[model samples]
Target: MPIYQAPVRDTLFVLNEVLGYERYTNLPGFSDASGDVLEAILAEGARLAENVILPTNRVGDMEGCVRHDDGSVTTPKGFKEAYRQYCEGGWMGLAAPVEHGGQGLPYAVHTAVAEYMVSANLALLMYPGLTQGAIAAILTHGTDEQKTAFVPKMVEGVWTGTMNLTEPHCGTDLGLLRTKAVPNGDGTYKISGQKIFISAGEHDMADNIVHLVLARIEGAPEGVKGISLFIVPKLKLDAAGNPGERNTLSCGSIEEKMGIHGNSTCVMNYDEAEGALLGEPNGGLRAMFTMMNEARLGVGLQGLSQSEVAYQNAVAYAKDRLQGRSLTGVKAPEKKADPIIVHPDIRRSLMTMRAFNEAGRAFTLWTALKSDVAHRSGDDSDRQAADDHMSLMTPIVKGVLTDKGFEHAVMAQQVFGGHGYIEEHGMSQFVRDARIAMIYEGANGIQALDLVGRKLGANGGRAVQAFFKEVGEFCEENRADEKMAPYTKALKKGLNDLQAATMWLMQNGMKNPDNAGAASTDFLHLFGLVALGYMWAQMAKTAQGKLADGANGSTSFYDNKLVTGRYFMERVMPETAAHLARLSSGAETMMALPAEAF
Candidate 1:
């Protein structure tokens, strides 16, 4: 069986040391997350993931979710019990507001714990993952009565939540949405439509399911402006605010998917379901984005989680499976052949995954910290700057992490050779599961387009410019430190390429829109390389500082960290040059071919 162990030590290193997680104690939730408290939470989360969650992964994949004739969906065995335990642990409300019955801890802490759980069993955790996103949306945009009626139970995990936006004909274009809503003559509206590919839409794990549905109100407008969001529960609440009557909605069927079968992706059919307006009419798109952004970040983490677990299993396999003799010498004469780990090629693959996973963790936490500051800070300027960071990094995080994440999973699978391809080893499941992250939560291609077309030029390029300044200043600040020169120099080169690409887009893309379209993905990746390179440089600096301070008896840990960071700088950061070159070449040859020619 494949195995997974949460990287607790590395996560703490990124949080406490590199990210300065304690420096923000002034924030509302940060004060509660003391070093000791943070460690305890992670330790407990790791135990749950390794012991309770990891065991269910393959079983969930093999058994999948089942849909009955009555439209009730049953998850794989042990899922209901695991979910109950997860809720009882108060994990669902770790970072939620205290007013809403959450522990009110820092979001960074929640994110760290979330990584462990996701790495253990992504399909299972997704049930609550979607709930968390719904909580965020309702908290941000819901009315006081709405919060009272819904947020508490949802946070307690007694109920779950889902976002319903896609229809049979429309996936990306909201203007094409046909779901309609008409006034019910009371305060509510009648929502009637079919939504497809809704994850966690119908399940027996929770007592109730709250759905945030997007539909066009009667005669609101012609396109997206006509859209409105609604709070539609699977079971309508009674006067006592408990589930009373079955709502006019049902799971039509579960979609046969390539992966994440444990998550019931349902085709939902609504017949005049009673729903309340979530926000102002004609403002549904704006309200729904709150949940969408959170989901996008979570989806990015999913990619990293898969890569981490796959890398762990691959490393274990490589160290035990004996193969060809080492080219250097016979180090293991007792065995018939040396372990495959002794081979340079195997080492290369392992090192690559290691390098990406560590830096990827840092990048994710860094962004999560930004989210904390944006939401918790009292000062307007501080909040704006933090929000700007989120706006700029979300796409890069979603696109780059997922794109590389899937590639690394494939590479780790390659280490197992034929054994990896077969189902017995479970590497194929990792590959299949990781595949969806790249396509969902705004496909990587769309993420790239958003980065290039909307985000870069927003606010007169304030976010991108601020990003460049931060990285450039970091490079300048560390130029004189000999130990930091390797990482800083490589990061500086990558940053320069990103800047050049940005400039090229500004100069040429405006004249020819197709040029921007062709360059979008490359530009987003180039941006991602620099962002991760920045992460590596910061981590390298932290590792050097700790080592100079004696590392508190962790010499090996700090030493290995430096080695991995250096590997990323040498092998991975240079790819930015290729992205820059390709993007600068423009869309001429690429777009010259006619569509019919193929």
Candidate 2:
């Protein structure tokens, strides 16, 4: 059984002390999000996650989602009721607009709330997570009527949301997708296509499922230029504004996968389904990105949440398990053996997981805070800078977090040795579950390509440069802090390395386009590690200040933050050195291999 306590207190430290949620709350559209309100909301969410959602996870996994012969899908037992609890508690609409029945909280607070659920039950939480993004897209790009019709239900959790991007033949390459939406005379379009790997695609968790689909408009253009987004409801709407007639969209079947089986990953069939355009015709990819940005961040949280949960279990197990005498000689000779924590190797594995999980949390919260600035800042220039920074960081957040998150999970499992691999120990589930995050939401490799080939140069390289400038300011301001010296040094070194790599790539890629594709992955990870280290430093400074003021009491939390920050600086941050070195190696090193090299 995976027992997950919401790291509520720790989350508060990150939000209130580290990120200064107080100032963030003062941002436009978030005036009501005071520190008290944020804490109260997170506390309520923590209780629900611990008492309601967490308990259902093992049950959901063991039961999984059922694919009925009649073409319906059934989520594991207790999910529907739990989802109802989530909705009734206003969980789904944490960051949605107040007019749409949402609480209109700051995205940073919601990020903390979601951390609890995802850590407790990611498979189950995906139901509402996707819904939140769907609601965001419709609200941002949909016609006024679409918002009036769709936003309320999604916010109320009466209907769930699904993203329809991947097809049988396409994942990241939208240009290759063949799904089409033919305009009909009566205003509604006819969407005809098959979309695969749709999470929460077909489930009984809600009264309806709203799919924000991408398809080609007839004769619009070839490739991605022709792609457009549509709003396709599983249940056709009635005149009374209720779900009535059956829509042409149907689930052909659901997928059986290695993990996340609690939610149905389905093959959807849209046979001339009546659909409405989300935005201007032939402008769907741009519209779909409204949803993608949110989904990408949510997916990044999945990585952070799972790694945290896995770390908790591994630490508990390490402190309890008795093992052979430590190499330094056992202190527990009177007892049968020393607890595993006495062993240096076990400590290394457990500490590695902790280092990544803590840094990941800080990085994610910082990203969420940036998202808050991007959406709510009143100053146009400030908002644009925030958005640019966000655009630059999204792929790193999604790619590096998921990639490293899986590593932490596996490393945590290694703490349990054989027990981690065995099903009875409940450790393997974390590894199995975290695996898909890397492949989905645009595969990590693809995310790297997007970071290097596109976002880095968006608006003429200003976004990437502005990002470094902000980090430089943070480092310069805190360079003299007693506990922050190493952090400043590590962060500055990492930033300089990333900048050198960026400059070298631009100078080299001009002559060889192939160089960008070959080095993107390493470069992306290098950038991600540096960003995480920057965040870890921020966390350490905050924790140390709190301890100086006698705020943390006798707990090890503050000391642990300092240790983990140092560990990350020493171990994980060095990864960038290797990656940057590899970036200088020509693409031919990888491309030169024969097709049948094996």
Candidate 3:
């Protein structure tokens, strides 16, 4: 009734059938997670999403987190209970390694599960999502004592986590941060600074809150490199790893944002906070990157998930909302009026959202699988390759997904006509909720610059070339498929466009650094479109084979894939051309304005 189905079948297609994630179980550390185990995990995750979490979404938006004068925050009613159920269910550490008391499942499985959780409730999902990233960073770079003290607690969901990188004066520009970490006598540090736009900064859902703070050492270098990361807890740990004294960190205020009201975006003040160092001294920026990288992918998942939910509801509404007769005569003539879905344009928008949502899922899984491979594989080359792929795709995952993802949400809202503007219909909330994802986690513009200016040339372009080479492999294999001739050809064209765009950015940026900043956003989108097109083609090929097998009346399942693939090729894939043209036009327009220009 809520237009929210598990999408379980499609998730399985991506997990077991297409990506073959079960092979990870063979890895020494991932022994606990196999096909049957992951399947069960997904099943339970779906049950929780549909039953436990979906019920709270509307209420969460209506009654967001309440901030109090006592510096404590209370979540909306039922949020605490729902989070308890989630923690008790072990969903918090779905992909964490077993050594840390996590479930040790493949990230591929967790990604599919994440789609469900977010579609059910994006706001509530942010709590654990941010926590998971924080714990991951601590585990990777934190001292042994820190890990022993904090890892199990977070992995068990007793406490939560937040990333503190933004400030009122600086957000994406970390170089401007004035947060200070002065060395103390006890080998600890005293952190005093202001951090803004921190999600889950102050909440009542968990016992203790672990904040990974990015601040500068007093005499450190001026920009990003000068900063260091520290682990500041809401409740200071005692000798046995439990919340003891209150840490000096407190919320200065919470941000009033356009959307995601349930998520507390805090303006935190770390006033002489006794904080333990996470890694090496003056290595805060590097340590903070661990959290940022994880957060970036998570933000992308948020985008894709919003698109999926919006598309689902829009499709349901279109099929049910009746207005007028069809131009091609009415199939539902006896029903007083034809369903809105009968109109070509309405179907166009629905298919647009549906196709993009489906392919976006595949792309996300593909990206997550790369992360899994990087972590699981024993070979150094394979590990590095997977890491390289993950790094290269992170920007696309964040920038392109959120940008197009917002478009998909808006398009879905349009399908509802006037009703979408009204909040009771639950459509406007999707739009509002998804908009912030584009702004946070390095901002979509910053992601684009990182992709174009940094990752494109990282390792001397080996990463970029390796990815293009993989696309070439996919294209070569698909050229022989009868169903993929057109798809393959279109994919090839998009690939050429991407390669040319990449080369142009690389050559031009070497001449003028500012040019990279100007052209980054367009080039990122161009890269995303081309990459997604290839993903869809591969998905179509796989779906076609599965459909030909005629397993369990999956006709509609794979039939929709072919139809949606066609829609994307015709409508969506053509978007790269415009972006490519924009990239070629040069960055003069972006940098032309003088300072303080009206």
Candidate 4:
């Protein structure tokens, strides 16, 4: 069976050392996450992930989710129990506001723990993951009554939540959605629509489900301008605020998907379900985006989580599986063959996954810190800067991490040879599971377009310009440090490539919109490479500092960190040039073919 061990120590390295998480203690929740407290939380989270959640992964995939004749859904075996334990442990609201029953910790701390949970069993985690997004939406955009009725229960994990936006005909285009809502004489409306591909849509784990539905009101304008968000619960609330009457909504059917079988991806049908408007009328897209943005970040972490678990298993397999004699000589003559890890090609794959996972973790935590700053900072300028960082990086995180996450899973699977393809080894499951992250929460292509078409130019390019300045300053600051030379040099090159790509898009994209469309993905990837390269440079600097300070007898860990960072700088950062080249070539050839040519 495939095994997973959360890299708690590596997470500490990123949090305590690389990101200097303690420096932000002045923030609202950061003060609560003292080093010792953070360590204890991660240790406990790792224990749960390893001891409880990891064991259920293969079983969940094997069992999947089942839908009954009554329009109710059952998650894979052990899921309900696992979820109960999760709630009892107070994990569901690790970072939620204290007024709403959470621990009131920094979002960075929550994100760090979430990585472990996701790596343990993504399918199981989705139940609460979607709920967190819903809680965020209601907290951000919902009215006082809506927040009072929904946020506490969802945060407590008694009531899971989902975002219902897609219909049978509409996925990304909200304007095409046909879901309708009509005033029901009171404040609530009667919602009638069908939404497809809703994860954790109907499940037995929670007492209720709060659905944030998007629909158009009667006599509302056509297209997206008419859309409005609604809070439609599975069970209507009583005057005392408990689930009372059944809502007119049911799971029509569950989707048979490529992976994450343990998650109930349902087709939901609403027959005049009672729902309250979440925000202003005709402002549904704006409100729902609050959930979508959070979900996108969570999905990005999902990519990293899968890659981390897959890498762990692949490394274990490579170390144990004996294949051929070492190229150097008979290193393991007593065993008749050396371990496959002795092979250069196998080492190459393992190193690549390792490099990406470590830097990816840093990248994620960095962004999570920005999120905390954006939401919690008292200064308007600080909030704006942090928000800009979020808007700029979210797409890259969702797009690049997932695209690479799936790539690494496949690579990890390849290390097992044909054994990886079979069901027994469980490598296949990782490959299958990681595939969805690239496609969901606004497909990677759409994420790329968002990065290029919207984010890059927002606020007169303030965010992108700030990012360039920060990275350039880092490179310049470290130019004289010999130990940091390798990482800084490579990162500088990658940053330059990213800057050139941005310039190319600005110069050529407006002249031919297709140029922007064709170049967006590459540009996003180029941005991701530089961003990760920046992570490696920072990590290298920190590791070198620790080593110089004697590393407190943990020299090996710091040494290994430097080595992995060097590998990324040498082998991976160079890919930025390729992305830059492809993007600069732009639209002419890509859009040359006629419509019927294929």
Q: What is the lDDT of candidate 1?
A: 0.93
lDDT of 2 by residue, 177-236 (tens): 999888899888999999999999999988988999999988889888889899999998
* Pairs in clash, predicted candidate 3: 228-284, 229-284
lDDT of 1 by residue, 1-598 (tens): 8899999999999999999988999999887887898899999999999998888899999999999999999999999988998999999999999999899998888999999999989999999999999999899889999999999999999999999999999888888999899998899999999999999999999999999999999898988888999999999999999999999999999999999989999999999999999989989999889998999999999989999999999999999999999999986999999999999999999999999999999999999999999999998999999999999999999998899889999999999999999999999999999999998778899999999999999999999999999999999999999999999999999998999999999999999998999999999989988888898899889989999999999999999999999999999999999999998999999988899987
| Predicted candidate 4 versus true structure: per-residue lDDT over 1-598, tens digit per residue | 8898889999999999999998898899887878898899999999998888888899899999999999988788888888999998999999999998998899898899999999999999999999999999999988788888889988899999999999999899889998899999999999999999999999999999999999999999999999999999999999999999999999999999999999999999999999999999999989988999999999999999999999999999999999998888877878978999999999999999999999999999999999999999998999999999999999999999999999999999999999999998999899999999999899999999999999999989999999999999999998999989999999989998999999999999999999999999999999999999999999999999999999999999999999999999999999999999999998999988899997
> Once superposed on the true structure, which residue ranges of model 1 sit more than 4 Å away at CA?
none
Tens digit of lDDT per residue, candidate 3, span 112-158?
Answer: 89889998889999999999999889988988889989988998999
Give candidate 2's error at residue 43 in angstroms. Answer: 1.4
For each candidate in turn, give its C-alpha RMSD to the true structure in angstroms.
Answer: 0.7, 1.5, 1.6, 0.8
The CA root-mean-square deviation of candidate 3, after full C-alpha superposition on the true structure, stands at: 1.6
TM-score of each: 0.99, 0.97, 0.97, 0.99
Against the correct fold, how does model 3 do in TM-score? 0.97
lDDT score for candidate 3 against the true structure? 0.86
| Model 1: pairs clashing at backbone N, Cα or C within 3 Å | none
TM-score of candidate 4 on Cα atoms, chains taken together: 0.99
